[model samples]
Target chain A: MRSRGAGTRTQLTKLEELLRELRVEEVMTRRLVSVSGDFTMAQVKELLRKHRISGVPVLEGEALVGVVSIEDVTRALEQGEMGAKVRDRMSREVITVFADEPAVEAVKRFAHTKVGRLPVLDRGGKVVGILTPGDPVGRAFRVMDLRYREQEQQRWQQKGLGLEDLLGEGASLVLRFRVQGEDFAGAGKASVQAKRVLGRLGLDPGAVRRATIAAYEAEMNLIIHTRGGELTLEATPHSVVVEAVDKGPGIVDVEQALQPGFSTAPEWVCEMGFGAGMGLNNIQSCADEFEIESEVGRGTRVRAVVHLSQSGRKDRLNR
Target chain B: MRLQDIKVQLEAEQVAGSPRPELEIKEACAADLMSDVLASARPGSLLLTGLTHPQAVRVAALASLAAVVFVQGKEPLRDTLVAAEESGLPLFVTQLSLFESCGRLYQAGLRG
Candidate 1:
């Protein structure tokens, strides 16, 4: 169950990492849903139904006074007091979260208090927003996704020189990138870059895909197994070559590592959907020519080549 | 089959990305391990998985998958949904187990 050199990084699951990084204010709903204290229970019930919400903060002017819920509304109706003021039926003691607090704190509060929502207060103790069970996680995902897309687009824009125009017949181009070890957050990036570059060069779609997949798996191996490494892509009109060279903590058994389901990745890494013992095999399968060289204490190097078929080469030349 | 018909057959909820009713999806591969996906899945195929982490969406994007469906009523983390939307990968959630979801899709003429 242990890969000789895997799981040496922090063990925080992705969700735990996100919760620590996100603040309550970033995730809370800023659109306030409130009912004045003077509103009758009958009116509160109608408001809840209209908004498709279970509860709302009760307010007196701009001051948060209490919270009224569907349960309270039901109780009022059962008691034949639908006309009772919200102030009388609302829960006076509220469990609140601060806008600046880590989202983890709000999650803990929810677990301990068993409440569906908490009013979010700013430093001045004024309610700024409402924190629901789903808000923090949902918001964190959105923010991270946006960041990922932006970074990818920025990389694409930065490499604006046209590879298509640069390479003539009998000329080849090389693109190199550094892969940081245990940097799971930045994994797969180099492959994406290579894929885009190959696509722009008008390589065959199948050849580009194979090279990209091989490069990705090799990039992942460098991140999971070594201190750090370099991913290099060399492309010509007829073939694409992907190479990964990493220093130290080399594989003890290169033959064993090539087998599917022979992963040495730890439990946590496996849970994250990696370390499945399939990276090497996957890389090998995608390449028309594959090579690996390793020295247990020195390093490991992998090279995979995907050749463009006759039709692919003709299509590239015609373009 | 069209993605819209597959959605109806699976009785799934579209959690992320806009629906393209006319989008065609002819193949699907079910897996929790991402490497298996990168190894075998064809481009434009649908991915059915129980893995709810953002990595699942990342792998789907890397492999050029047409969409992802989370089986067994498993809700993806908020980050996962956001990644799907940002990557322009459609996501769905179904109450059926993986076996049942695959069975229904297979019966409806979809292949792995």
Candidate 2:
């Protein structure tokens, strides 16, 4: 049980000495793709497709204003809660590294920090490029480990692909995908795909972001916190709806369920950098119209709606 | 007013998640949950809450709050207090209900 057959898959963490040898200037991927805070969501989507990056730094005339990730873009297309403003969902006060420092330091920072990207700067603080520790070779090995084992595969199992499984034939534009609940490896995939759907349909980015956050939270709720629920993505010309119904033991208190800090997830969730108890509240925060009904003995139903035509909203930045 | 002034109004105990004593204060907000407080609290404000965990401290850091007051004489967990200590934030403890504590601070010029 201790090994769980994870022997060959385990890769050692980088030592501090290795980190100390890493200089920010050495490993950074040069030629950053940046967007102004005023850039349209359509333009940002194009940038992601072109650069093949998960995020882009948002510049307010070179003050290093904020950053837009694939997650932000997805949220915009899904619910449009954050509006067309890039500053709304962008992470301000981005973590950074100096070129004179060791390259391994970037890896250490990435492992420790909540954010995924670090902008590299030289002595004078001019932007050099970026560094992302994504798709580590070790990870590819771990993913390959799960490829053959049926017992291990059960954790990430899916009944089928596409929305028809969760919602009947009446559901339109059925968006379907599997939840990597146990691994937490690809939890947001479903929501991100749904966001692209909205963008292609010319839905507002503001609405897209909101709906995506709510939907992602719900999907994560199913994957991480509950016993795993199914997702139903149904959209019409005027509104987008996400329905997540999980067969967990069901919520204990609807009132407390609506309140924040009301998480029942184990402590390791926090250790692994997931489950901040923001799941339910974040869902409530973004959706234009939200409804939830759960029975203690059975399951839970969360329905969220986002309109198609809402305009810009003032997005806040946190230092 | 500065943090030293607000120290006089607290219940004279160090609750677990309460920030340190030296950090400066500019305003105050009293809430138990993480979401609305994150959405509403201003920068450099003092936060009063019943939540005694690291997430609260994380929000406090993200919002750039100066101090966190634990009302009802509640003790913050070790992790929360440790985060506050690491952040060098001021921690204050008060033996009062959420309503009365907020009311007393409002009377003392700690505007919402």
Candidate 3:
């Protein structure tokens, strides 16, 4: 019994993690079927039967005033109070969940309150949707199934790849991203996308990490230095290549820029925890093969390649 | 150390995402610069920073950090919280300074 309890606990933890990744808005029913407070319980009974739902929220304008459930409808009919208004018959203490709150919160409320549904509200206290117990569970199961399939696909792909075959055929996968300069908020978006794509390709974990780091650095340089540029990631079975190309306001001295801790970034840039002069150095160290070329008036182009077989190599400076 | 232990060590208040107390945190990197965190922080390591910008959350997500702890009781900006929610990156705030937070975690046997 103790071991069984332990197993259940672990499973619950896993489920909880998945739930944390999801929001109430994602799992809740958005096509809300609601009736106004003035509607008769007889009317609510008809609405519930028409929608085949167990419950509906009673709204006063946009505000959720109460909940009228199937049980209430039955009681109203039995007590010969079918003509009573929903506002008087409905349960006023309606438990609610926030639309933006983690889905787990709704699960907790469901567990403790034993309610069939909870109206989901937005930050402004407006009813947006309703969450049923099955919604989160169904969503969690779907997400878990999807994740399992992805992992299986990654494993199958990884097993199918052979270095010789890849090199002989010269087949490669390519991904491209456009980076906008001075878009601090939008920075790192490309690298994150690249990292996910590489992971899905089933590359070596270390290789993926190195490639992601290099891609992020290159993406950053594009955002900080140029007006805009494009980042290209080309992947073969044996290697991952990251390239960043920008149009103008190029570097004057490529050698100086390559030096560690040498940054030409302004004070505002430094305060944001960037322009530490580590971008190029980071890319150089992560890549098994690194190259940089710039024409003073033209833009800079940096490329870094991480070999799959050399995934064991550590980031020298970082370690 | 588990995230629960680190939370206790720093007396952190989770501001975004749900807590995974069982989540293992083997290392941590403390830096305000997103670039530094990207260059050095290992995947699954915790990030300790004073920067509450959304970019900090983005950097943590991009770098695959386990979580982000904002030191000095600094609540993240609204956009940062939104980013955290979107990325599923757990965020915490501590009244402790960055130095003190790091010290507490180190004392609790969490390595950098």
lDDT string for model 3 (A1-319, tens) is: 9999998898778788989988887677656899998999889989999989999998889988999999999999999999999888999998999988999999999999999999999999999888889988776765565566557746745575443354456778888998999888888878877777666555665777788889988988988888999999988867889999999789999999999899998787788888899999999978999999999778899999988754322222232
lDDT tens digits, residue span B1-112, model 1: 9988988999986776534567999899999988999988988899999998887887887787889999999978888876776666778889999999999999999999
Off by over 4 Å in 2: A1-172, A310-319, B1-112
lDDT for each residue of candidate 2 in A14-59, tens digit (9 for 90 to 100): 2333345434543455556888888877678888999788888887
Grade the docking of candidate 2. incorrect
Which residue window of length 10 is worst by lDDT in model 1 chain A? A310-319
Which 10-residue span in candidate 3 chain A carries the lowest summed lDDT?
A310-319
TM-score of chain A of 1: 0.50
TM-score of each model, in listed order: 0.62, 0.37, 0.66
* Model 1 error, position A312 (Å): 3.0
- Candidate 1 has a DockQ of 0.33
Full-model lDDT for every candidate: 0.82, 0.64, 0.83
CAPRI verdict on model 1?
acceptable
Could you list the CA RMSD of all candidates, in the order they appear? 15.1, 22.9, 10.2
lDDT of 1: 0.82
Order candidates by lDDT, high to low. Answer: 3, 1, 2
